[model samples]
Target: MAVVAVSAGIMPDGYGSDRCWLNYDRGFIWSFLGPVCCILGINAVLFIIILILLRTALSQMQHGPAHDKLIKMVVFKTLVQSVIVGLPWILGFFTRSSQALDVVFHVLNSQQGTFIFLLHCVLNEEVRKQFRSCCRRMTNKE
Candidate 1:
């Protein structure tokens, strides 16, 4: 799609094109359609993964507490991933480049890492227990 847009002169070159900046230009809307479609495609894939996870979780719901926790974690991760990946792209469609938006974009970009760390390390009971044990060992050494 991007290659076609570029070849058709609808999209600007990455380095040499003035349209690389966040201003409107001729064919800009058509050019942006490529990335817009890409973003939408990504969201669609994520949605499918979320649906699969939900279905699997539902089927395992009557199994036990483990499945309950897994389901909750999967849902939380899916929501976080969507916001982290989708929000900045959606906002970019509205705003031009700016200090505030740049900061926000960076923050949103990092949220996936933070959320994953929290989900796997902080929220997991087993990881928390290991972390606490390591802390105790360190403190005892001190």
Candidate 2:
């Protein structure tokens, strides 16, 4: 992809085309920096919420049974989903288009948006699991 981007002359001269898509033209700082930082900030917030929910579940679980297996499964699933969704944008970043960098920026933005949605779904599922467990415990107590 970097080769393609270089051959297409999208990257300025002297820059190593071997760099990862995200690293390319990153020196501009202001243009790509702001958006990347914003996306990461949002992701961090969502990640924190996921962690809190997971911790709550762990705290609620009975010591008789280890929930490590379930926690690992959820974490693995989330990681796989994230990698699958992110692969395309990573590829796109390396490949340069004839369109201006603005187009690339928009494409990256859209990819980030999609990732955010997927992240939300992942977090929502964790929250739902916690809710279900709470309801089950309440019903059992009654």
The candidate scoring highest on TM-score is 1
Residue-wise C-alpha lDDT for candidate 1, range 65-111, written one tens digit per residue: 88777777777767766766678766665455576886676676667
Best lDDT goes to which candidate? Answer: 1
Give TM-scores for every candidate, taking all chains together and pairing residue i with residue i.
0.65, 0.36
lDDT score, candidate 2, position 43? 65
Superposed model 2: Cα runs more than 4 Å off: 1-37, 64-66, 97-142
Give one digit per residue, the lDDT tens place, for model 2 in 1-142.
Answer: 5444554365344343464334345353223445545665676677668877877887688653347766766676556555545444444443455355546655755677666665665456677798799899999999
**RMSD (Å) per prediction:** 4.1, 12.1
lDDT for every model?
A: 0.68, 0.58
Q: Evaluate model 2: give its TM-score.
A: 0.36
What lDDT is reached at residue 72 by model 2? 69
What global local distance difference test value does model 1 have?
Answer: 0.68
